[model samples]
Target: MATESRHVTEYIDRPARVVYEYAAEPANLAHWAAGLGSSIRREDGRWFVDVPQGGRAEVAFVARNDLGVLDHEVHLPDGGIVYIPVRVIADGENAEVVLTVRRAAGMTDDEFDRDAAAVATDLATLKQILEASA
Candidate 1:
């Protein structure tokens, strides 16, 4: 069965390479991705974030590549894994960052809407951070 999904995107006034480089770094997530956590830490080469729901979630990002894929998997404390698809697309002199938020199994409509809203806010935060730095 296909799950409901929404693409939350933000146009960042920065080069694709620059945006990708910054966003790809796990350490930088705390600066823009508050929905994930307020802070992130690396232990034994693994990235962990304090989930808002009260436990820590391990975030594993795909290996860096020339392609703009920033896909990652979040391992929840309850043994559930959520796959998040993210991408950085070149837009002339700027870049568009898109995050695909999927409605998890058995998630309610309100929950899905909230998830999308949080993603949108996070993307906007990313845009502000990158554009301000430029």
Candidate 2:
């Protein structure tokens, strides 16, 4: 059982209070999530992600809090599925986000690799936006 993993670390010049607000807000997910070219839809207690390259993924929200984890299941257009584990940790002047995606059918390893950088870029962009406002 090999798990696909990616990690991104950034030092934000802004305080946690400001960054966390944007990170923790469910609606604000689109702002950053879009960087990965993902469209998010929330309805019926589930968040759906429309990934053009991979396909549609739907995850039921189990729990979401200030310092907590969000679990989602990635479903392929061809009927394959895998679990995507995401965690958000608050760092004094920065925040740590870890997104782990399990590989599924119709998904290539390269796609996962690409997302690793895409996510980091998105976070860095967010960092820039928040720090600029501060």
Candidate 3:
């Protein structure tokens, strides 16, 4: 069955490379992504982060690149992998970050909207963190 997906974009007053360099680091997810955790720890060659709901999650990042591609798969506690695609693009001297969130099946409309909002908030935090540092 086809699923619902949405994309949210945030603009930051920083260069794309600077934003990408910081955001691309999987270690920084906890600082920006509330749905993830406040701290991330590496164990047994795998990276993990604490979830707000009292559990930890496994995060497997894609191969690093220089083109501002920061894609990773979050292994949910239920054995489902949520693929998150984040991009940092140059907009003049500034940068724009775009995130794509895919709604899982059986999610109610309200739940879907909430998930999107959470992502937007996280992206905003990311923008704040990056821009403030610039």
Candidate 4:
């Protein structure tokens, strides 16, 4: 029961530590992740964002670590959960960010392609923001 997946990556011209630090912050998601809505808020020690699709989705990011893991789970309003696996790996003096987009059980080919394209665009946006700020 393996699901189809796509690995979208972006090469950021910044140190891995710097890229991870900025991206790990929940507040910074609005700057690059348009798929997650443009604003995020914290309430009762939980992070929530108004997803582009409609209702709010609770986001739970992995605990801060030195291993560059930025995985997170998005709890949909309808009770479905989506797990996103992301990472920042050191590439010489720069960094490479990879996000794995999994095709949902009932998702069509067109939907999967759109999802992957969105992830790619988000990664590119991340690259632009981090590089320009450096």
Candidate 1 residues 21-83, lDDT tens each? 999999999999999987899999999999999999999999999889999999999999999
lDDT of 4 by residue, 1-134 (tens): 99988998999999999999999999999999997776898899999999888899999999999999999999999999999999999999999999999999999999999999988888899999998998
Residue-pair clashes, model 3: 0
Worst 10 residues of 4 by lDDT: 33-42
In candidate 3, how many Å is residue 11 off? Answer: 0.3
List the candidate 3 regions with Cα displacement exceeding 4 Å. Answer: none
What's the TM-score of each model vs. the native? Answer: 0.98, 0.66, 0.93, 0.98
Ranking by lDDT: 1, 4, 3, 2
* lDDT values for all models: 0.95, 0.63, 0.86, 0.94
TM-score (C-alpha) between model 2 and the true structure:
0.66
The candidate with the higher TM-score, 1 or 2, is 1
Candidate 1 whole-model C-alpha lDDT, 0 to 1:
0.95
Residue-by-residue lDDT tens digits, candidate 2, 62-122: 4545554655555656676656566656676556656654444456878766766676777
As a TM-score, model 3 comes out at 0.93
